[model samples]
Target: MEIPLSHFEEYIDEPLLKRGLSYFKNGFVHEPEEIRPGDYEAVVEGSEDYTVKLSIRNRVITEHSCDCPYDMGAVCEHVAAVIFYLEQEELGLTQNTKKGSIKKAKASSSKPSKRKTLAQQVDDLLGKATHDELILFVRELAAKDSLFRDLLLASFAQYNPNESKTLYTKQVKTLIKVARGKYGFLDSSGAEYVSNELSSMLGLANHYIRKGNHKSAFFICTAIMDELISALEYADDMDGHLTDTIYDAFDTLATIAQEDPPEEVRKLIFKYCLTSFSKRSFSGWDWHLNFLHLAAYMLSTDSEMEELFKRIAAIPKSSEYEVKKAQEIQYDVLLKRKGESVAQRYLEQNIDNPSFRARAIQDALDQKDYEKATALANEGIEQDSGYPGLVASWYDWLLKIAESQNDTERIILYARYLLLKSHNPKRDYYQILKEIVPPEEWTNLVEAIVQEAMERKPYYRTDLVASIFIREEWWSRLLDLVKKEYTLDQLAKYEKLLAQHFPSELADLYAERIIRYVENHVGRSHYRTACKYIRKMIKLGAREKADEVISQLRQTHYRKKALMEELDNV
Candidate 1:
């Protein structure tokens, strides 16, 4: 789906860079992805912590279902990368000749030359053909559906509900109406055959629903739903990944309600969606999830969904979907299970796990299982009572859940644990702080907490304390921290960490780090983040301030000694 760079520039089409800059204060690192020829689904490194099944085909995106709150928001970077990569690909075509010569020639060929249809063209791109061949094939077939194209570009981020949407917009919707008139509704034998099936599903269902034929609409929609699920089962590489596809189908289905079924039928249909989901064999903690979606569909309406949810809770252990989903969906299901039981079960199963347990807790919390979460947090503390180790898993676990709950005292307590017991955990605490208090609030916390800690001990947690001053956003603090904390000898250690971990933020550090690097570095003043801040500062009527910061950064104490020493050696 990548377009040519020239086409990209001309059309104001957002590249991943522009896209990132739009959404994030700091530019996003767009991890590149590739087309898996085996399935034609786009593939990227999933957040190792969560099981989001993201894929792309044609220039269209189909993301895996995520339990993260952001999932509904379309917040995952994998999805962003998949979508942007597809655009990058479509535009990658602009570099080639605009002759339409390839298209003419491909059309002349008798072979299954791969650009005959949208689906086929997608198949061709996913094939081993060179980039040029793929684009040529696609361009030959690519008749831009203007409204459809816009619907796509608009929905890529999933960052805001008001901005994007849970389903298609008004204009693109005319497509279904237009097509339904052409094709007509009421395909007999309760089966359908159509190209662009999701599209056809919309058209045919709308045709029936528009006529007050809710019976036909529901029937056809269910058939299309079955086919969509069947397609997921049929896809090669993404075969096992049904959660995402199912959710997409669910959301798509939500939009197709021509007339809300009678209260009786809606309840009946809701029960079927809930009860029948157990018939399938779902994996991991997924089996229990089917009900979550079913319940969301019902509860989001005028009807009371709690009794239905209670039925799900009352499912014997003999039922499918597993315990995690059960505990997680308690609030949504209206079962009123304590978050503590859920957390205890999760912790008991996940003991001896470290890097991944955070992921587990986040997922559980995503489900609103606060009681089990509290229990798990308490259990983690008891399992390892020693301060250093206990705080590693336990205190941070509570802080993580507390952040979601906005428990400032819990956040401060965990911050104290890291500051007091493990100086090395400074970086970890700051990273977590971003999730809790945000960047603007960090300094206030630092001022209050660091001062309090200093009264209790000398050197009050050295490793991460310096992180607060790295932001050019807070210039005065940066200068003060550097001047007060580091001696001439310690500058080397401090500068190295800045280069490695805090490079993006250090640009605002009065440019001392960048200036020092100019001597040893061939790319003089080569820091990207630093240069970016300089421009930002200039734009804000702080040109003189910017220059002064840059100069001080260049001439600072032993900060530049390494750069100079290295340049001389070279």
Candidate 2:
């Protein structure tokens, strides 16, 4: 049960794990205390303080819970941070002080002498330096690091108001140039690194905002967004770091725009949004829709709003789908400027698309018009029933409305449809059925779904189906299905699940797999793999079978020295 650093990744999402590592590196986890043997608790500072408790049984985390509102059914960032703190302590990367906080342990001594940090030393020197000397020192420093020079200029550009935009534009260009590699390409990690640097620039922009330099901040944010959008084509941003940074920059601009900025800033934001929208290169992306929404929010004059309407109307209707998206954008803008009634009217006028129909249903629900919402929801499902993905979405909407109205019958009906009829199964649907259906009826309901899935051509064994069987401890049915469809290699992944209900059967299964593997493959590596499985089979009560298989192999492949050597070791 001694957990390695590698095991944590299996229990958490990579992004959350990375964020947790960042938190631990920045000392955000504090005051880890042992509540008792094998149990520890700590507080992690995120958007708010969250307490995390970890139950360590034999050094592996058996259980963890956090007082954070993350409902993803996996470990959250706060709990991950606490786990990282514990990992650091276990690895001797940190030392606990008397106050319970952890700090880096000194290698040379148990207690290290306090010394001024480099920043403090620099501050002391700057405090004693003459004004002329300080100016010369800054000039030299800026010349040494171009990035620092750009940041310095951008940070102080508000004082030189006339040149702020030019300076920021130059900074964006320089940063983009630096981010590109020799072939003008950015890999995923490079994209992330560039994004982190751009985020630091955003930090400087936020500082300008806090200082009430709205124009400077607005220009900087817009420049970043524009340049970042241009960089997207060159970077392999599969992890979405660059996209998230762009969204953050846009949010800052939107927040400032909400304050009713000066006309100049408003026009600049408005123009930027329009230019971004008109760019054909940026089309077919959700961010394009977001840009339209921002432009709608920034529409200050009737003439400006009219211009937006005309521009949207002029977008070529290349396909039915593109036309629908254009109409949706118009409806969003109308919803913001005009009212829900106007938006509904616009939606009705353009209700040819399934997405628009879904929107109308949402609008009905927003107005508490349950009848209208239900009718629209049903209509959407009926029209798009041929498309399982679309029908699933409509079913989800129906379920939402049913839950809001406390209509148990409708909830059960929609949940049943989602469970049985939909190709894509969701666990929440099963949970809903479980909650609303009587306990006596739950088993029958699950059996009916399983039977239905079994009756399908070459039976569909999905995670939902597997989870139901496992949750109910229906081991026989699960094992039959697994044996029918899964190979020996795949079965290895389910040893824990299989061991829970069929230890002897699992042992036999592993023995059969090892015998087949050893007979088919011949090599030192294959022999090693076979030996690994042989050990597992023995651990699970198949020692006799494993010994027989090894004896037969040794006699048959007696001339193979490597195989003989591996078997001897085993």
Candidate 3:
């Protein structure tokens, strides 16, 4: 989380809060700097110096991280110390005697030698200990700490190695068992811990892959994939950590397939992928078909190719995305098993598949076959008329063909259509229109575009017209748009552009919308938002207007104590 900076201490554990406060008072946060606005970095003195980075936005700590091995809770003491250091003035922190004890002790010591880092201390201790003593200590520690025991076996897999898939499956199950609560459900934090632990196992698998031990890596990857699929039933993976862990395992398997492992290992992977897909182990997920992709790469025999083709053809066309992925996988199989001619034939037959259609169009264009490309694009446009995105893409292809042929009329046609209808943010159809349209007819054409855009619903039309006005330097029209229809959010979004050219008018609009916003909404969040716009008004050289807005809120919403408290901050 995001924690409000004003009362961050309340959200942290009491013990952690005290420790962080002590660290802050002892001046342990060194070289604190605002590296960028709302971003801070500092070296927080802990067991050793740890770098802490914080991203704050709108007076809330949106994200924070520290290079300290503190994962017992969300916010570490080092991160808290840095936050306290940054907000010392706003928080009104003062160093009492007890709080300053650590600093005073350092000040009083005559020979204050620097302390050893954790690594150096560990090395020194290990050097002093005998081999038997080290063994005994480790054995006892491993016996007591399940986490340490699992980590020990995983990290030193080369020693006392059990290169079996069950070895890793047992380790993962133990981790999940330990993380489960009384009801056998993992909470959010527990789920994160399990994900991190499993990820380390996957990392070891990767290491095995690098060491040319494909069998061991395959075992680890498959075990994690199979076990985590079941564990997700009771685990609260709200943060998607567990899901990502499964994806990582899938990706690792893909990497291993690319390595072209030994025949036995490849056969094992092929069987596992086929079994997983048939069992629908990853049903309702894209991985359900992604496993098929891996299986396709592993195909070696004519019978195997036929089996994979049957599996791909059996996949339900439940969604557009899944249908496209399935069709693409089938195309890959055909291309690999048969010749380009056969795959091209398949693509032509399934031209409604956007990916295949796009590929066919590209192939046609690559051969300078504009006629074929034009026919294919027109067919796609007619077939995929329901999908605006696909239609726009087809039009984009047509625009390219026209540009290649120097057909200015078709360019203007396609470009103007895309500008009005296409929601793809990446394409700059507006600029394309400006460049293609002749200078003499530009004004009338732009007016027509504006009228078409205005005919859309207000929610969609306002931003489009406003953007056009901004680009065309129609500041007055933009201001009128905001005044007539823009919400408070929309006003703030476009304020920076209009602030310089129409500061007074924009500020008045903000004042009006702010009042209307408060009249309709309640709660401290709404109050905070209202006050935020008031501050924005002040930033626009309208301090007096901001004050009047505040005055109106106080008189109207005086009974809302939360609102009054928020107003005080403003």
Candidate number achieving the greatest TM-score relative to the actual structure: 3
lDDT of 1 by residue, 6-101 (tens): 233333224534542232222222322222321223333333322223333332233333222342232444334333433433433111123323
- Per-model TM-score, in order, reads 0.34, 0.60, 0.73
Ranked by lDDT from best down, the candidates are 3, 2, 1
Candidate 2 segments whose C-alpha is farther than 4 A from its true place: 1-161, 178-197, 232-245, 280-286, 314-329, 352-356, 359-378, 393-417, 426-451, 458-473, 488-501, 514-539, 546-570
Residue-level lDDT for 457 in candidate 1: 65
| Each model's lDDT | 0.45, 0.75, 0.81
Task: Highest lDDT: give the candidate number.
Answer: 3
What residue runs in model 1 are displaced by over 4 Å at the alpha carbon?
5-197, 229-249, 252-272, 279-290, 293-325, 328-448, 451-477, 480-512, 515-570
lDDT of 3 by residue, 1-570 (tens): 788877898778888888888888877877455555566668977888887777677778876766576768888888877777766656656543444453222221011114553456678899999999999999999999987888667555545555677767777777787777445777565677789998888888899899998998898888888888999998768789889999999999999999989999998988898889888889888788888888988978889888777777767777567667878988888887897999999998888888988898899899999999999999989999888788889999999999888999999998888888876644798898888788999999989989988887643566678889989999888888888874898888788788889999988998998999989998989989998998999889999989998999889988999988998998
| Count of clashing pairs, candidate 2 | 0
Error (Å) of candidate 1 at residue 256 is 7.5
Clashing pairs in 3: none
Model 2 per-residue lDDT tens digits across residues 1-570: 223343776768888988887787777888466555555678998898887866676546765666677767557888877777767744465544546676783331101214543456677888999999989988999999887787678656656748666777777776666656445676554676678887887887788778776787888887777777788888868779888988889889888787787788788888778878878545766667666777877888878888778768877776566667667777877787888989888888777678788777887899999999988878887887778788888888889999999999989888987876666654468778888998988888888888776666564645556777877888787787667643567677667888777877887777667767777887889989988877887777778877987888888789989888998887
Between candidates 1 and 3, the one scoring higher on TM-score is: 3
Clashing pairs in 2: none
